[model samples]
Each structure stands twice: as C-alpha cells, then as structure tokens.
Target: MATSGGASCSSSVLPCAFSRHYLAVCAQDGRLRVWNTDTQSLHREFVPSAHLSATCTCIAWGPCRASKEGPQRKKRKSEAGPAPDQQPDLLALGTAAGTVLIYSTVKGDLHCILDGGHNGGVNSVQWHPEQSLLYSGSDDTHIVEWDLQTGKTRCKWKADRSAVTSLCVSPDGKLLLSAGMTIKMWDLETKEVYRKFTGHSTTVTTLCFATSRPPDSDGLYFLSGAVHDRLLSVWQVRSDGKDKNSVVSFTLTDEPQYIDLQTADSKDKAVRLAVVCKDGQLHLFEHFLNGPCKKPLSPVCSVQVSSVGAGEGATPAPVTLLAAALCPDRQSLMLAYGNYLQPIVEKTQINTSERHVCLVRDVHTTLSLSVNAAVSKVKTPIVNEQKGKVLIPGVPGHQAPIRASSGESDKRKKGAGPTEMSIEERLEQVELSTLGRKGEDKGASASLQTDSFAVLLVQGLESKDSKILNKIFQTKKEALIRNTVARLPPPAVLPLVEELSRRLQGHPFSAILTVQWLKAVLTQHTSYLSSLPDLVSQLGVLYHMIESRVKLYQRLTRLHGKLYLLMTQVASSNSSHKVSDLDREAKLVYEEESSDDEEASGDEGRPEDDSDSWEEEEDNEEEMDVTENKENHTEDEEDANKDAEESKANGDSDMDPENESEEE
Candidate 1:
C-alpha cells in the first residue's frame, strides 16, 4: 500500500457484481485485490500467477445466486423447499499470458487455471447467467467457453478478426454479445451470429446491460462505448431484426473510458447511464432508454474528479481515470485512478421544505481513509505476554468497545441540514444576475431589455426570421437552450422543430446548437406531438431535412479531408522544389547514359544472325510446302486409279453374271 510520489494501479479491468457486494480490481503488478462492500476494506489480495512477469489483464465476478431469485421463481417454489442460505462467490481473473485463474471467495483459494484455449493475452471474461459456463475473449480473436465444473473447454469460436475487447450475456441466458471491431450478437446454443451491428465507427471496448429494463421499452436495452470514439450508443437486443437501429447515440467531448448503467433514482424506473471519459469527467445521462423519446441523449451533468476534493480556485492535480462503477444504492461512484481507489458520493442535503437537495461538489476525499478509520475501530491486535505470540482480534473473547468523539457526532448532526441552494435556485440567481447586467447596458432601450431569450426565440419563429433565431442560439448553454424551449407554448413545438431543421439547411456551423434546441422541444412535448395525427407530414419533413443535413456534413468532411491531403502534397512539393541546375543536369545525363546502356545491352542480347535465321525459316517453309504438294498429288493419283479399278470390276461382273445378267 506504500508508494512513491506517483504510481498507478494497472488500468486493466474493474468489475462490480450485480449484487454489489464486492469490487474486484486488477493491477499491472500482477496483483488481484478484492474490496468488500460492508467492511469497505481490502477483503483479500493474491497474485494470479507465480511467474514474476504475469500481469492481470481482466477480472470478472460470477453472478450472485441471490440475484437469480424473482417473482416467477417465488411462485414456482411456493410448494417446494426453501433455497440455500449462501453460496461461495467465484472470481475469475485473466492474465496477460493467456491464462485464466478462477478462485473462490469463501475459502480464498485458487480453483482452476484455464490456459489451453488462448494463444494471446485474454482481453475479457464473462460468466453465464444460469449455468457453470464461462466465456473468455482473447487477443487471438477467439472466444472460448469453459465448463467450470470439469475445468475444460466446452466450445471455442472466432468472434471477430480483431481481438474481442468486451463480452456480455443476455439476461435470459439465450444470447451472447461480443464487441471488438464490430458489435455482434450470437446464439448461445448454436454459437451462430444472430445479428451484426456496425453503429460504432471504431473499436468498442465496453459493453453493459441496463440494471433493469424499462417497461415502455420493447427489447433488452444495453449501452456500448468505444475507447477511441467519442460517442456512446444505446442499443436494443431484440429477437426481431429491429436490432439494426440503435436507440440513441450520445456525442461527448472526450473519448469514453467506461460506462455504468443504473437507476436514475430510488424509483428504479428511469435508466441512468454514467460514462467515465478519459478527460477525468463523469457524464450522467437519464431517461435515455425508459420512454418513447425521439431525441438525442444528452448528459444532464458532468462531475470532474479532480474538482471534487479541491478548494475553490485551487489548482487540482491531474489524475487519469481508468474505470468507474456505481454502488448498489446509486449514491456513490467508485473511480479507479491508477493504483488508487476513490469514492465520489452524491451528498443528499435535506431541506425542511423540499425533500432533498443534491450537492455534487462535495464528494471525494479518498475511500482509503475511510478504510483506515474502519480498521482503527476494530481494536488492535492481541499478543500473549507469556510467549510473546500473536493472536487475532475477538478470538479470545476480547470484545473491544468503539469510542466516538463528540466532534464526530456533532459533525454528523450538522451534515443533515441543507448547506447550499438547489439547482433551480441557482438558475434563478443566474437569471437575476444576467438581467441586472443587461439592464445596466441598455437603460433606455426598454423593448430590448424587456425581451428574454425565450421571448426573442418565440418572436423569431412567429416572424419566420432565421437570422434572429440563429443569433439567439449562438451563445447559449445546453441547459439554457432546454429551459428556453420549455418556456415556449405547447403549440409552438412543431414550429420549433421545423425552424431548427430549416436553419440547419442554411447554417451548418449552428447544427449542434440547433439540434440541441430541437431535441429539447421534442423531448419535452413528446406525448403532445405524438397525439396529433395532422403533424405526421411535418415530422416527415423534419426527418428528411435532418437526414439530408447529415449526408451533407459527411460529404463536407470527406471533401475537407481530400483538400487537406492535396494541400499537404502541394506544400511538400513547394518546400522541396529547390533542385540546383547542376544537379538537374547531372540527373538528366545519368538518365541518358542509363538509357544508352540499355539500348546497347538490348542490341547485344539480340541474335546477330537474323538474316541467316530468316533464310533458314524460308527454306523450311518451302520444304514443308513441297512435302504437302507431293502428298496431295499422290492422293489424287490414288483416287483416279481406284475409280478406274471400280469401273473395270463393274464391267467384269456385268459380263460374268448377265451376259447372262445383262453385264452388270
């Protein structure tokens, strides 16, 4: 646990089980560590291999037995016996040497090693939902299914031409999902590909299923992100061919490192997806897959890890975020930065009038300190005075009392009250500040001062002024755009979408902002818009415009790339155009000499007795002609003689038989 000024725990794989009881992390130093939820301490640690060079590459915790229980099982088992009380937790750690080590948490012992299948480093490992089968993907571009009971490979197949980076099993245990160069779904029984999705433009490194399916959704919802791509896609796993279309694709400012899906709130209805980006920010998205939404998924907020524990205006040290997982309660996120594990909690501030106010700015202080505090409360080790031998805590009826300081109790009491204003209140304060600044700038311009962003936007749409609308949206934030759209009358939603779409045809630079506003309006009034039958034509027009704009942008991007390449070539040629006249003359002379040498060699290699060869060929041709004529003359003579003989024979036959036979 001691380290130098800077060191990173290997950023390989960090997996939190469905039950959220344990979090398993692998390090570059070939160490496998497990952290417990209850104790919040290092539950156990072990090296995956005895080889000093072995490095852990990926980790997977088996599905908890208790999570398999549901209403259907309860109804079926009403007449049957009760289930077992506990099952040992199984952990699978894949190493860089193409070896997989399985261990049991109950006994903390190595169970088996699966090393015969992969010839390259293992990239990912996933557990089957309802069986003892384990699926592992390796850099060899092969997926191997291992039977845990017998410690043997049950099946192995090539998943992709590229290394399979991530794997997930469907909840019903009927399908297996793999991602690498492309996303593919496979039939668990036959191992044939069910469907292929080419939505992501780069290599996909993460795949996760929603914690729970939203009732409004028709298929199993899941999330995928590529480490090299700046977009996160929400896809539906359907038995029907509707899986080709992704539910939504979210654009981000930075490439995503990890994605975790959980409930947005205590209701467990809305699906919340948290994407941890390489830029050290956690992007939170809500209500993306729960309802009938036709808009793009946008992040509600982004929390920066470095800013969480830093004081106001103090520069925070940059840290590389490797992975993130939501705790079971959805109140805290565990972030892995190199070798350090940090917990960021969403502190709930209780207001007497309002139920709760979330303050995200006060979350991180290192979970290691908490672990140390917990260890301290457990009492020191006991030693025998007679033999000076060591003893474990609470083994010899030594129950030490836990003492709490008064200041700690007081601090806990004060923590319950609200210490800051809510988001709405902050927005109102910002609005006031903005108004004050505007009033100071334009005291005599009453009309301009009276109109707010929403008013200006509504007026622009009513008058069909594209310039006004574009100017209004040029400098606004996403939240401000959404708020402005929400302030519009319900009947104006269609006009907003139409205006935004039309503007997109003219101004490609404002597409991002216009799309933001358009999505906000559509999302806010989805039910209202879907209820109207007469609006179908307008919606179609909007979709057509969006599709055309996308095509246009893609074409522009391609053209820009070509132009850039051409310019680069021109620039290089210009820079290297300073060839000296002497050098050019030498180059031409060398070329001329080489050409002359080639001509001389060509003449010398050719046969010098060309006339003699032609005479011999002519003589051979004449001899062949003479032989052909002689053969023809002989055949003609033979034919004439045969005809004469036939006539003589006929005459003889006639005299013999019919001088009697009328001389044949």
Candidate 2:
C-alpha cells in the first residue's frame, strides 16, 4: 500500500477510510471529500444540498471483490480492477440527521440515500466484508443493519440504554461487537445478545478487533476503550470453550479522544496502539497480544501535536482529535483535528550487518593490541640480558658488577632500616624547628623564639610542649597568637590558654596577649565554646583580667587628668602671683623715678646721680628677665595640656570608664 508524505487536508474531518488507492473523509459540514494517495492531492468533494444541512458523523468504504460474496460478486473483481459494466466501489456516509448516504466512488455522485435507519445521530458505521450489508450505531441507543442492495433496514435492535457509540464485526462476520455504556456481543444470525461485559464505569467510546491470538491458545480478541475511567480492556473468545479478559490502565494526563492499533509488520504480528488525547498530544503504546504476561498494553511514547500559545499561567486550550488512520505499511500515521491533517512517519532502524561489522572490527583490533603487548612483556627479560653484555668505552668490565652489587646492598640496607618514630617525637621535632632551633639542639635553644607561630601552637597543644608553648606567648605578634588560638577547637582553646598563662608567669606583655587571645576566641566562637563547661569556667580568669585592666587603666586615666588639672592650676596661680609682684614693682619704680627726677633737677652735676641711674638700669634688667621666664613656663604648661587632650581624642587610653561601663 502507498502512503502520502506531507499531505494534509482542512479539518473538522470526522471519520476517515483508507482503500488501496483512495482515502475518503467525512467532514462536520455535511461534506464528503476523497483524496488520491498516489498524487497526494484531493480528488473530489461532495457537499450535501442545503435541505440536508447536517454534519456527517461517520464514513466507511465498501468491501472489494476479493472480500465480496454471493452471485453478484462474480461481476466485480479487485477494488482497482472493476469490469467495464460493473458498478464502482460504494462509499457509505452516516450523517447526524439519522440518514445513511451511499455514493459512487468513481462517479463522485450520490447513488442512494438510506434514511430513517437511526432516530438520532449515527456515531459509527462498518461494512460487512462478505455481504451487501452495513451496520451502524447511533446516539438513540439503536443498532441498525441496513441492506445496501434494497436501500432498506434489514433489522434494528437496542444495544444499550445510552448512545451506542462504536461498533465492530468479527473477522468471520458471525459476531458483532457494540460499545455504549457497556460492551455487548451479538450473534448476527440470531440477532440476539450472546454476552455482555460491564466493567467500565462510564461510556465506552471506541472498539477494535485484534488480528492475533493469545499465547498458548488460538482465540479471537477485541479491545475496548472507555471515558471517565481512562481504561482499556481486552476480551477473548476462545474456540476451546473458555474465555479470558483483562484490563490495563494508565495515568490520564488528558481525556482520551480516540485509539487506533497498527501491526508493526505483517510477518511479525507485533501490534502497537496510538491514542489521541484532548491535551494536544498523541500517545503510543505497545500491545503484546500473544505474550504470557497478564497485562498486554504498555505505554510507549507521546508526541505533542498542538501547543497552547496564551503564555505561562494560562490554561491550555483543549484539542479534540476527530479521526486517525494508521497506514498498513506501519511507517506513517494520519491524524485529523480542527482544520488540519498531520502525517507522522516512524523512525528507521540501523542496518544489522553494518552495526555488527563495526562491533566485530573494534573487538578484533583491541584483542590484537592486547596480545602484542603481552608478547612483548614475555620477551622483555631476554632483550634486557642481551643489552647487558654491551659496555661503555670508559667503563671497566668489572665495574658493572661492582655497581650492581652496590645497588643490591643498598636496597637490602633500606629494607632493614630502623623502626619508625613515635607521634610525640615527630611533634617535638616540629615544635623545635618552629621555635627557630634544630630538633637535636634542645639545650642550646633555651631562649624562647617563635618562627612559625601557627605550627608552634598546634604542635605545642598536641604534644603539650611547654617550651614551644612559652615561645608562642613570648612572640611579640598579638595577631599571630590570636589567629592560632582561634584555629584550635573550642575544647582545646581553654586548656591552651591555661598553659600559656602558666608559662607567662612574670611576663605582663605575654599575659596580656594571652588574655586578649582568649577573649577573641570566646567572643568569636561562643556557640561552640558555650557547650564546654571547662572552657566556660576558664573564661572567668579572662573576664577578671579584662575587668582589672579596665579598672586600672580607668584609674590611671583619672589620676593623669587630676594631675594635669593640678599642674594647670598651679601654673595659673604662679602667673597671677607674678603679675601682682610686677604691678607692685611698677608702682614703686614710678614713685622712685619721680623722686630721682626732682633730685637730679636740684643737684644737676652731682657724681652720685650717675651711680644711681646705673644701679636702677641693672635692677630693671633683672626684673624683665624674671617676667620673661614666667611667661615661657606658662606657655610650656599650656602645650602639655593640649598634648594630653590630643592623646585622649586618639583613643590611646585602654579604657574610658563611661564607654566601658556602657559596654558591660
């Protein structure tokens, strides 16, 4: 059979049928369209008259001559080989107006119209392969068998209380299966229900017969798919007087609209089912009809046929798949929906010979390489022996032997070396090296020296090395000691602090650094440190040292301030005293000058007047010197006070009692 590639038709295509040469499609607008599969083009369109303005619900093609029976069939041959006087293959179209329209495929003309077969819309129709009969199920809960030759209903029966949604005939045309609210099997000759299957909780919408038998038995099987429950069931009719049934289910991401089965290959008998869902996705499943397993249907994959374009956070629009047809070649599928028909082709498989050849070649190459490597290894000793005979021109013949014996002796000596050192010895060596001394020179390294503070701290804590511990405290770098102590675990930090304190006996600088280190560790690691009671108890000493230092610094600061105030007051008092003395001297000098002026006027050329002037000048010079010295001293005192104020502004003092108390 030929398949179309990239061919699609405008949608609202309800039901579709495929023959060898032509594809017939019924649309919602009461129109029937035919397509030529070879040319991938529309062949004809048949639109019903305006008086019959009802949607076409389903369609099917008449059986070819090969499948025909009775005396009238002798006049017809194959579907593509009708005699000159024979009629063309017929097309049956079921409409929502409860009428069945028969058209001529070749002439593209309506030949017969079978009306009043269904009271409500006909939902499904199927033509008998070996008889001039057509069966239809409708929403009015009726199944009608129509005689195409006479254009009349042969019989009518009620299949269910609800709408008869789908119908299928057995391979031998003896049994008919109808699905509605339940599935029922009817004996065509007797025209009576033979059996009823009623497991579905909702309406059964689709049915199809399987062409294969079950495992370890020869039996006919059919599948039923239902709504609301999203269940597909398999029922068997055996020839050995036994029947079997099974149900398979899956998570319904969306409501199932239609299901179609296709055999993978006619020779292999492997079947796969395709389901079109309302969520714009077509899901595929593999059905193992002849397998020994209980469940026969398994999910394979799904493909998205449409996409919601309303952006995120918006509900996706529902898609209704009206019809689907799988090509007999099992390579292409046709899906019908709103205004579109899409064809999907199956993926091809790799060639078995080419794959096997490449695999074998890779294995052969790898094996050959491995064999060559092993052979080379097996011959390596002989090759080395041959090379050993050749010697350099500068070397003596006996020298090689001597060197070989020496190498052997060295290996033996190394293998028989002394036992390994203990953990304490190794730690001691590391500590001594960190303290800027050779490990062997412990006596000469009496003075505390810290080269690597971190190594010294870790080794000292681990080995309890008192010498290294003392050096860590003696190190002038406060930051180095603080960082090393902080790196230690909370449990070890307190003991290390106690040890450093013990070693810091009379060294105030070391003791202060140790206390600062302890405070930093406690403050930064309080969460981990608080869990250790010993560490928390040891914190008392650190707090005490900090408080004492704070109090001492505060007292020293207060004393300094008081001393400065006292010095300034004393300087001011002295200045005032000197000013008073100067005032008195000025008054006395003024009176003396007036008296001298009068005496000089009275005894103008006396020798005593010259001596008195000289004496007065010397006294005035001495008084001026004393006043200059006092002013200089007062300026010095003011400069000292300014310096003290600047130091206080720069936070040079260890404690400010006001800020310290607030912090506490």
Candidate 3:
C-alpha cells in the first residue's frame, strides 16, 4: 500500500493502542492495516475484505483477558470442532453493507463474516468485555446488540440522530457509551437507552471512558470529540447524583474529527490523549499521573506533528485517522497513513515508562529486604506464643454460642424448672405441659397470662420476703420461686415501676408499677403476665384474697421489670418514685387490716368462699409465722374451712378485680 493524493481517503475507524504494539486502521478500501506504534514501522497483522464491495467503516478489538467461555458455539453443533486452543485477538469490523467481519491478526486467512447485522451501514462497533456484549451503531440511527455467541442480533433500538456514528465501552464495562450529535447511554443489562447526554452541538466524532486503577470499579467518565465546536470535550458521565446531565466538562483547542484516549496502568493518574486531524496532522497530549492539574495549559508531553505536510502552509489534508495501535506495553505508536491506507507510519514514541516498586514504607518489604532482619521474621514457629497484649491462639473453629452455662445462667436452670412442684407450689402458677395446650387458659384474663414462668427462671429468682418465704416453706416442702412474670408499667407509672423493680431486686425491696408494660400494654394487656404467685397460701379465704392481691401487686412487678429495664435504657427514669409509691401502699394494707385479738387465732384455711370472707378474715388477723398453724390446727383448720365457706357467700358482692386481693 502506498500514498496517493491522500486527499479523500475515507477512513472509517482508527483503533489505536499504546500497549498492544500495533496501530489498527480500518478504511473504505475494505482492508485492515497494522503498524508498529513506537517505531512507526509495520507489524505483521493485516487482513483484507473478501469481496471488492466489502468496505469496513468501523473496527473494535476483543478483550485480551478472554472469557473461559470457550470457542463460539453454533445454533447447531458444526460437523467438526475448532482447535481446542484459541486466543481472541481480532478486529471486529463493521462494514458499509450492514455486515460485521471478525478480522484475525493473520492476513490472508478466511475471515469470520457476520452478515444480517443492520438495515443500513454499520457505522461504529465496540466490545463490552465484562458484559460480553457487542455494541454496533449504524446509519439506521440505531444501536444493535449482537449475540456474538449465537451470531445474531439480540436487540436493536434507535440511538443517535443523523445516523449512529460512534460507540465505546468503559474499561470496567459498566457502561456502553455511544454518540452521534448527542451522547446516548444504553444500559449494559437490558440494552435500554438510559439517558441522553446532549452537551455537544455538532456530530460526535470519538468517545472513550476513563479507566479505574484496578481496571474495575471504573465509574462514569467520557472523552468526546465533536465537529461543532472543534473542541475535544471531557465529561464525567455520572448516572447518580445531582449532576446527571454532566458533572464536569473540559475542552480541547481543536475541532476533533477523530480522537483516541487511554490511561496507562501507571497508577500515576495521568491520561493519554491522541487525536487525528481532518488535515493530515496528529496532535498527542500526554498527562502525567503526578496529582491534580487545575487545567491542561501545561501537559506532561505534547507531540505537534506535520509529517504529512512538508511546508508551513502545506496543509496535511488528512481525510480521517482509521486506526492507530501501539504496543501492548504502550511503549510505541503506529499510524495508518495515506490514501491507499498504505505506509504504516510510526510516530515519535513518548518515553513514559518508569520503574515500579511495591511501596517504600511497606512492612513486608522492609522485613524481607533488610540484611539485619529480626530473628522473628526468619524463624519458624515451633509452639504457640502470646505476642505482647494480643493472643493469637490456635483454636479450632467449632463451638456453639450456648455452651454449658457457668455464670448467671447456670443458677437459673438449677433453681427453676425442677421435675416437680412441691405443696406450696399448688398455690403458685404451674403449667402441666409444654408440648401443647389441651384447653385454653380461661383463668382470670386469658390474655394476661403467657407461659411467663420463663421470666421467673431467667437466672434464678430472688425475693425480699425471705422470712415470709421460710415461714411459708415450713408449712410444706414447696418450691421457692422468683417473681419474673410481672407486667411492665406505663409512663405515668414509669417512675413508680423503675423504683419498684429495682428496689425489689436491689434492696429489702418489693414489687411496683413500670415503663415497659405502659408501653407494651396499649390494648393487649393480657399478652405478657405471670402464671404463678410468689407466696404460699395457708388461710383458705386469706390465701384466695392474697392470690388476688398478689396478682395485682405483681402488676407493678411486671410493669417495674419493664420500667427498670427501660429506665436503665432510657434517660431521666425516676425509679425512686416507684419505691416510695410501694412503701405507701404496703403500709395502708397492714394498718387497716390487722387487729390484736384476730391476730391470736388468725385467718387459716377457710372454704372456697367469696373474696370478702378473706378480706374480713384478713382484717381480723395479722402476724408473722402463719406456718405455726400448719401443725397447731390441722384438724380445727380443716373444720373452720366449712364456716368460712358459708361466710364467703355473704361477702361475695364486694369482690373487685382491681382491689380484690393484696396478698400476692
């Protein structure tokens, strides 16, 4: 191939690579040319169209890190399989005749022609390496996605105006960027037009995205060359954030007809700028990776060329830059020059290569490179040793979160949930089975009681009335339990409950009202409650009254539990107020109910009468050691139960749910 007038050599696409060692040029001549980028010499890669009418207008290179997804399979398996080994390095050529040809590096080899591509001229092509999608823009004003594996168009939709002219995929393959007069974004997944970027007024000539350091996680950034302003525009294509239109924009001096851009993995952050002129001139812009540059007034390197023109006003008159491929290491530059797409011109190579090192301050490097390295660095481990405050013990990764309980939890299991309930337990709440309920709990407020014995057992139970407990225990060998099933109190009772649950646990305390229950029980008051009581009952009528009263008192207990826990959690929780409220209430019961004469013979096991008999009997008697009667009046006590039963009927009218019994 040699130079003719070079006036109107209609070059379609110029594929330039600094790292690939070759300049790829696709021209209207229906031929592909490869040139050495650095030496401006010709490399061996070249391919020509099979038919005279085959004119390639666009070309894109496939990914180097080819998918392990093997050779392309057919709709039906072919007679013979291709060679098991295949390296994907080819020019995906888009032609004017609406067909695509896979041009390999080897010249004179049969090309893999993909026809039936577009209805009109295939103007541009790009490969999305990550998406495994091929984007081809055509004069049909559409971008078509080809199922490269199936050799068919996956989907096609209208894209740019005045015929789709250009396409580019991001390095990380997150976006498929295409342009004509306006930049249109197509989603990689659904191939839908996401957004149209319309900053350029004239036809867009070139498009490229900034590559992230890791070559992945590269976000939206594009460099576009436009004919309208003769300015190379740099835009940040942010899909997310306030600036969806354009986040940032930079302009170049020339009206770029053909432009190619790249960022070296140099990690220096500098970008490479290469543009082909309508006049046969090439201007190169080298950006250094040093740091942020406010503007491009001073670039790292600039190559101002006049190779095609001999004199000052010679006018290079370059038609189009079809392709420019550099070496794989970006150490060279190759150009496809002249009308015949001949003379693979090599350009002045930019010397940008620098020595790479593993960071100077790295601990591993310092440890390995030092001649006087510490013994620890080179020594082999024989046994486990604790290093300073940190312990790196070799333990097997096998242990349940719930091991054998040793701390607070152990006391609970051993103290509560025993095999059997004792005699006093008959007075307390106990469920028959955990398997399932045979009958619904209709006792009192059905909603009030849950399987709340669980709370009582949370780490064993504690109580303020140890003597009342010991005395009660003497009447029968029964279980001593904690009052954990108390309901939480409301905000009004928040201070009260906090004071009580805490005092109940903290000091010679008693139960009171609280915060959690106030919050918990808006309507479902019966959901969480105690199924058992704290004390053993000896006086039948009194025991019943006490059961009712204790149930009421424990309301504060449950409420206090919630409040205590809450106040501990919430701010300005007045727990002491609850303690005082309880003290006042306790005194009222003792003073109004007990008299000396009634205290002598005392209220003992009476019949299952109405609540007033217990209240009346409670008013008659008050003293410690009700357990003494267990032995003293075994026979008489059994007899008095009958009269109390008769009297219970007389006082049945006064029993109230709230004020019924205070013993519990």
Q: Using lDDT as the measure, which candidate wins?
A: 1
Per-candidate clashes come to 8, 1, 55
Between the candidate structures 1 and 2, which one is better when assessed by lDDT? Answer: 1
Local error of candidate 3 at residue 508 (angstroms): 99
Query: What does candidate 3's lDDT look like per residue over 1-664, in tens digits?
Result: 0010011112332433322444565432334656555466555534343333456676566655443364434412566523322233566777778888776664534346666768888877777666546778888888888776777878878775578777876565666777877887667777777666777776776776644443222344556666645555555444352333443334444455455555555445556655555544455565544333355432233333222332244333222233343333455555544332344344435543332111111111211212575557566756654443422111111111322235435554566444233545433433433334566344421212322432222212223344532332122111111112232221112222222333332222122222222233223333212111111111122223234446657787999899888878654346655666664435324444346534645545545667657666564443333644565578688778877887778874456666656633
Q: Which stretch of 10 consecutive residues in model 2 shows the poorest summed lDDT?
A: 395-404
Candidate that scores best on TM-score: 1
In candidate 1, stretches whose alpha carbon ends up further than 4 angstroms from where it belongs are 1-19, 50-52, 66-88, 211-218, 238-242, 263-268, 288-295, 307-313, 316-323, 327-338, 341-664
Q: Please report how far candidate 3 places residue 179 from its true position, in Å.
A: 1.5
What are the lDDT figures for the candidates, one per model? Answer: 0.61, 0.58, 0.47
Q: What is the alpha-carbon lDDT for the whole of candidate 3?
A: 0.47
Q: Give the winner by lDDT: 2 or 3.
A: 2
Clashing pairs in 2: 11-339
- In the range 1-664, model 2's lDDT, one tens digit per residue, is 2111111111122466655556666532335677665555677777654323455777666665443446447545455653433223777777778888888876779989999878898878877867889999888999999998898999998888889888887656788889887888899999998677777777676677765343125446677767654556676555553453453444445556555665322325556666665544566665545523454443565544332423245333333344455555565565544332221212222222231211011111111212234334444434665346532222111111111135534664676322233456556766776776533554222212222354467677777777877666665566555555554543455556556445333356666666666566656667654543223224433443445456668888999999999999999999998888764434233323366544534434534546447667557546655776787799999999998888888976577688999989
Checking candidate 1 for backbone clashes, the offending pairs are: 8-339, 9-338, 9-339, 654-663, 654-664, 657-661, 658-661, 658-662
Off by over 4 Å in 2: 1-13, 49-53, 66-88, 212-218, 238-253, 263-268, 291-296, 306-324, 334-664
